[model samples]
Target: MKSWSSYLKQFAIAIGVVLLIILVMDYNIRLDELNRLNEKATIVRAQATQAIQTQVALQTQIAEATSDRVTEDNARNNGEIQEGDQRVVPIPATGVPPLEISVPTPVPTRVKKWQVWMELFFGE
Candidate 1:
């Protein structure tokens, strides 16, 4: 009977050691997971803060866009002349001719692929 009790005691001790090891491992895994979650929360908080700042900035821009000065500028850009306003076309100085857009003449030159490769590798 004494031997039976000793064997039982040994078995219980072994089971306790196994359970302790498992608990320690589970605790470590849980700690790692908690650290990951904390990191993710920090990232989310930063993103949320940035989003709020962006929202405020966009609201300010909207306010500015709707202001009287902005509206008048937009109207003027669209060629809308207000009351009591005279449209004056400014002419260049008498010596300077009006600027003319000259279309570039297309140079019709045919080159082979090998010539293009040679030009790319060397010089024009």
Candidate 2:
């Protein structure tokens, strides 16, 4: 009877050990999945932020262009302005008339393949 009890105790311990191992493995898998989900969420948030910023910047540029056009129209209709005449604004202390300067379009920076991949995963 004593030998039977000893064997039963050992069997129970062995079963408990296996269950503990399985539980630990399951916990590790869950933790890994959680980490992956968090990383995906972070990437999505960064992309959204970049998109919003780009949209806002484009809107601001359009608004500025429209405002400039309106100002030019108003000046032309102000009665002091004549057709085919250039509006020369005097520069302070510079003996030179303020000229309308044409801004050149900026050249796009070259992107490396690896950089593009990183941007896709991590965003700018």
Candidate 3:
């Protein structure tokens, strides 16, 4: 009876040691997983901050684009004239009149059917 009890105690200690090793292994694996999750969270936070900055910049651009000054500048660029505004085209001080451009009429030449056939056969 004494030998049997001692053997049982040894078995229990072995089991306890195995369980402790498993617990340590599990703790290490969980710690590594937690580190990876923290890195991912930091990356997500940076991305969110960049998105917010981009949104603010876009909003500012929208406001500027819709402003009255920008509207008037765009209108002037598009050759729009406001009320009570006189548009004066500056003429050169030289008395020479602007030259007129004339397009020459293209003369059409008639081709004979026999010539066309000869040209096709000759590869010209």
Per-residue accuracy of model 2 over 59-123 as CA lDDT, tens digit each: 99888868967778877778456687878886597678878999999999999999999999999
In terms of lDDT, the poorest run of 10 residues in model 1 is 89-98
Against the unseen true structure, what C-alpha lDDT does each candidate score? 0.96, 0.91, 0.96
Over 29-93, each residue of candidate 1 has an lDDT whose tens digit, in order, gives 99999999999999999999999999999999999999999999999999899999999888768
Off by over 4 Å in 2: 68-124
- TM-scores for all candidates? 0.64, 0.51, 0.70
Window of ten residues with lowest summed lDDT in model 3: 88-97
Q: Evaluate model 2: give its TM-score.
A: 0.51
lDDT of 3 at 76: 96
Clash count, predicted structure 3:
0
Total residue pair clashes for candidate 1: 0
